[model samples]
Target: MATAQAAAGRTFTTDIPARLDRLPWSRWHWSIVIGLGTVWILDGLEVTVVGNIASRLSEPGSGLPISSGQVTGTAAALYVAGACVGALFWGRLTDRHGRKKLFMITLAVYLAATALTAVSFSAWWFFLFRFLTGFGIGGEYAAINSAIDELIPSSYRGRVDLVINGSFWIGAVGGSLLSIVALNTDLLPENVGWRLTFALGVVLGLVILLVRRSVPESPRWLLIRGRDREAEEIVASIEQKIEAEKGEPLPEPAGELVIRQRESTSFAEIAHTVFSAYRRRAVLGFSLFVGQAFLYNAITFGFGTILIKFYDIPAGDTGYYFAVIAAGNFVGPLLLGKLFDTVGRRVMISSTYLLSGVLLFGTAWLFSRGSLSAVTLTACWCVVLFFASAGASSAYLTVSEIFPMETRAMSIAFFYALGTAVGGISGPLVFADLTGSGVVGDTVLAFQIGAGLMCAAGLVAAFLAVKAERRSLEDIATPLSVEKAPTAEAVTE
Candidate 1:
């Protein structure tokens, strides 16, 4: 490998992007997926355990003196609040400091916060740690999504991203099953069971952190920051390992990107580039994220309350129902993910959002008429979320891929924070109160609101989603670090 020449305002051309995207799928790529992607599973477990345990936590013998409404509503909102703030805070750092460093730091933050949460002696203590835990997970979203998109080959980016994001439901499924064991008073005491869940999350996060240490920083990110020689070395190392695996020399890289390297991008520049330069995309991102956040928060946070209040199901039994829907959520992305790459982002995103919305409306109607049992209702949710999960997972993929490389982490953080703040914080509060009222009409109305927003987002995606599938990051949006002068391969639009 040749050394990258540099000047005061460093500018250079390198084939790092092409070198990464052109490599064949190998064990190394799987390592990246397992290392970075498993965090979502942990996230899913954290959320699902909280939801399933809301009833248990509200009981008299439970460790904390909190109501089911407070557990599901206030605590849930605080977690989201933490995530919103954390996404923006750590997201900025990820863009400035580099993906590898921020991801590792964020995971450590999560582990420590979760450990504290497991030892909470009061409601406030639990609430504070919930917020802190979300803070770490929120940073993981911006950092991991940016890294995954940068590292994965363009041909596989869409499906891989969808599966990774959807992996949150895998944790949800585990949480559901785990809650059954933990919440069984016959098996474990009430106070002890709830605390055990958080401890388990810390354990899983530790394993992910160990694997994540080996994952390299994004070469694209390194080159843009004037660390060209390090970037080349990383890519060269991967190529050698891959060729040895394939027993053949790799094909020549296709193109090069010339970057005027900078250590940091100002928030002002990132904001202008996203909202001003790509105004339509900005709207699309907000709509998609808000829609999914509201829909997921409404259902995930309130599933236990709804089952107990409306269906007379035992608190311990809710997990079985939730586990079914969680499976549906994961299956949606695994099944429909390929279409986003092959059939295109516009069709898959719009169709999944619209289809899921329609199904949810049907569920609301059936429930209003008292025409569904607990089993049937869970089935309905399973079907609706099958499509919704794919659409929601696609939302992350859209924001991460459609922005300039220089602003990737910040753009993801900005939209995720904005959308999640609006939808996530408010969704649980609203749903908790509505479902707690025990009025079928109130619950039905809540369902209608979530369904409406999802449909609206789908319509926005139909018109605004970019044709970003199977394209290099630079092709979708020009990097801010690129030279002002025209390059033969520079993507204008």
Candidate 2:
């Protein structure tokens, strides 16, 4: 590896980005996926457990004295608020410091907060802990998404990210099954079982923390920070590992990015980049995020309530139905993720969003007419979310890809914060109230609103989506600080 120190405020060139993009998929990449992608699973588990146990928490002998609506609405809203704040706070640090530092710290915060949640005895205590847990998971989103994009080969980025994001349903499935046991009087006492459910998340987070220790910082991020020597060495190490695993020499890396080395990017610069220069992309990201956030948050947080309140399904049986729904969510991304990289981003994103919206409208009509049983309604939900999950996962992929390298983490944070604030915070509260009404018409109205927002977002995507399939992140959006742009010939290579 070679070394170079930039003169103050001067520019330098490096092939680190190209070197990273050219490597073959190997265990090196799988380790990164396991270490970072598991956060989604943890988040899914947290959300599903709470939703499935809402009735348990609201019972008279349960430790908390809150109503089911309070448990799902107020607590869910506070968790989202914490996630919004955490995204901004940790997002800036992720871009400024480094991907490795913030991801590790954020995961540690999540583990601690979730552990505390298991011991909560009152509504306020539970709310505070849930907020803290959301705070940690929120930070993980900014840091992890940025790192994964920077490290993975562009050809694999779309499917890799979508599948990882969709893994939340893996946790959702686990949570649903776990709740069935936890809520079972024969297996565990009510209060004890609910507390144990939260503790399970802490255990999972701890295991991931150990795996993350082996993952390295983003070499592209290191180069931009003026640590050219470290960046070169890390890339070299990764290439060597990949070659060894493949038992053959790797192809030579092509292309070059010349950038002005900067110690840090200011929040003002990140904001200006999003709002002024890349304004249309900002709009696209916000629309995609807000739509999916509202729909997912509403359904995931309050689905159990709808089952119990509207269809007279017992609380214990909700988990069985939820497990089926979660399987559909997981299968959508697993099956459709490859198409995002092959079929292109614009068409797939729009089609999934529009189709899901159309399906939700059909679901609303059936429910309003009282024409569906609990099993039939659950089946309807599975089909609707199958398309919606893929669309929702693509939203994260869109924000992460359509921004400059320097602001990637913050871009994710900005849109995630704004979208969550608008949709995530309100979705649960609105659904909780509507579901509590126990009137099919009321819940039907809520479904229509969600369907409308999703359809509107799809239209926005069809107009503004970036055609970024199988392209390097640099090609999608040039780094803000690139000193000498790549020539036409180099770009084509």
What are the runs in model 2 whose C-alpha is more than 4 Å off?
1-8, 487-493
lDDT digits (tens) for residues 41-98 of candidate 1: 9999989999899888889888788888888999999999999999999999999889
The digit string of per-residue lDDT tens for model 2 on 326-424 reads 999999999999999999999999999999999999999999888998899989999999999999999999999888889999999989999999999
How much RMSD separates candidate 1 from the native structure? Answer: 1.9
Residue pairs in steric clash, candidate 1?
none
CA deviation > 4 Å runs, candidate 1: 1-8, 484-493
- How accurate locally, in lDDT, is each candidate? 0.91, 0.89
- Candidate 2: C-alpha lDDT: 0.89
User: Worst lDDT window (10 residues) for model 1?
Assistant: 484-493
